[model samples]
Target: MVSDFRRKKLLHMYKFLDKDGSGTIDKKDFQLAAESMTKQRGWKEGDALYKESLDMTDLVWNALQKAGDANNDGEVSADEWVTMWDTISKSAADREWLSQYCKFIFKMQDFNNDGFIDSDDYVAARSIAGTSKEDAVAAFQKLAQGKSKISLTDFQKLWDEYFLSEDPNAPGNFIAGKSSFD
Candidate 1:
């Protein structure tokens, strides 16, 4: 069950996602929201705008459908926001898969393989991303404002917030299947 605070947070998130403040989320809303989010992440306006033009709402809708659309009405309602939060909740959902993504980001950020990420790691990540340190820092700060450091917990949260959240037409599924070997 989702707590009231979390429900409110989800509703807030929904408001953000509904870029036009139209209440109902459709393809354009998803595109606009994604564009806004990517831009907020320090992506160049030209680049983010270019990417947003690509139509792929079906992909995003598919990944979020089960959780975001509780009524299964092909649209996300206010109450269904809580359901999406349930999926995002570490306690309510799978941890192993979440950690794998976190580890991936940790390795990427740990540019020197020193087992921890510091400012240098941030620089390296920015270099690889073809963005400046200022831009990278801006994006990080925008995402995690006022935080003193980026720890494993911080990485885990970022991994979920940015990487796990799928674009409407992204290639892979956001929710992974159970291990076949299990």
Candidate 2:
């Protein structure tokens, strides 16, 4: 059974991906998020970075649809999202999807393409999801554990903890910022 903490985290992730404020997540949501992110980074439509961001978002959306859209309706509902996580949680072999997702997110959040995510990068990424600067800073501090930045390897561990840990005090609980699990 999924713990309440893990369930909350899963739903939070679903909400984050459903960028269009619709009840389900579709390719359009991914496109909107990609556009928003590129715009925030000042990447114009024809820019290589902008195109890369779009491609990354498309890849993410395709993976998510394959894994979570159980009904094959071209969208992932909240129930489908939770059920997918619940099943994945029980199967150790099913974690490859999560690792790929973590890589994509890490790439997006590493604004400088420097292989690390600093507090500024964290704040900027969270800002796209409407998280306040203060909350993002606090969450990053907790997740970083006093470190100045988080590398991809460390982020993968935190990503696992975020999706799997039932502990309320887990550092990964702050992955979406302070308010997410509060």
Candidate 3:
């Protein structure tokens, strides 16, 4: 039931993510990608193959493997990579779980449920989400869409999409939880 447009987009993104062209990504792939991204952003100098800390590389490798390897093959087929990214991209528009997650975020953000997420409200949620102040503010700004406040409907839409996709009962949420946190 996947549409042509969405399918094409996913395929495109997969190519962009597969920097190594090895037909399969490993920890080295993520490290290279991260280093490239950092250098592209002008965070470092020179064209040398910058190395990420072992711990950081391990985390990225594990995340990509879990999210993109759909066939339990320990590697990502192009189709699997495309599907995984497409699902994440599509989640923004999903309405069910987004609504619930938004409510939770709002209630958590609003502190007293005063129908608004003020600076203080945002601070609390940021702390809870373990995001830095700048990141938290940026995330809110993006989610709020330049609005001064987020409506329940908006929150719900975002929440449902973000959370329901991970729900065990969700149709495409059948990802094998390889890790306990998964």
Candidate 4:
């Protein structure tokens, strides 16, 4: 069972993911974030770049639906989101669901698909989530540890801390933008 603190953290994350303020998480919210990225980057229509973003966002919606949409009604309510986290599969074969989901997103945020997330990629992804580029850059630089890249292990570790750790100074918290819980 997820602790109350962990459940609160998940709720914090849900607020961030509910980009459209629709009181429910759905595909359109994901699309809004994807669209924000493409628009901020000035990607023109029919461009393959934004299309990749769109497809990736769709994949996220699909994954969330598969895991958390208990009613099969296409959107995830706050209660359902909490239930999903509380009931996350704990089997040895599936114990890595949270990590895998983080890695999946980290992979997408890698931008250049170079197996690492550099400052540019980090800022780009953060911007889509409504963070200021300056704040994102500072956070990335602090987390990057003077390296120009962030490896998958490092990325996953941050995410682990983000979802499971209560450390106030964790870089994982910074990566999630302006979390009110912080």
lDDT of each: 0.51, 0.85, 0.51, 0.76
**Model 4, position 134: C-alpha lDDT score:** 85
After superposition, candidate 2 runs with Cα above 4 Å error: 92-94, 179-182
lDDT per residue for candidate 1 within 1-182, as digits (tens), equals: 66553344445546655767778665667666556445544546567433532323435545566546767777777766565657666464544534653565465466566765556566556555455666565554544445644666666665564423333222111111100111
TM per candidate:
0.44, 0.90, 0.39, 0.73
Ordered list by TM-score, greatest first: 2, 4, 1, 3
C-alpha positional error of residue 49 in candidate 1 after TM-score superposition, expressed in Å: 9.1
Kindly list the per-residue Cα lDDT of model 3 for residues 19-136, writing each as its tens digit: 7887665666656756654554344544332333333445555766776688777777777765665675566443333234235435545654688765556655555434567655
Error of 3 at 73 (Å): 3.6
State the lDDT of candidate 2 residue by residue for 14-132, as single tens digits.
88888889989999999998888888889998999889889888877887788889999999998888888777777876677578768988988998889999999999899887899
TM-score of candidate 1 on Cα atoms, chains taken together: 0.44
Q: What are the RMSDs of all candidates, in order?
A: 12.2, 1.8, 13.2, 3.4
User: Per-residue CA lDDT of candidate 4, range 1-105, in tens?
Assistant: 765666677788898889989899999898887877778767766998778778777876787788889999999999898877666534333235566567767
What TM-score does candidate 3 get on C-alpha atoms? 0.39
* Collision pairs in model 2: none
At residue 88, candidate 4 shows an lDDT of 57
Candidate 2 achieves a global lDDT of 0.85
Backbone collision count in every prediction? 2, 0, 10, 0
10 residues in a row with least lDDT, candidate 4: 88-97
Top model by lDDT, which number? 2
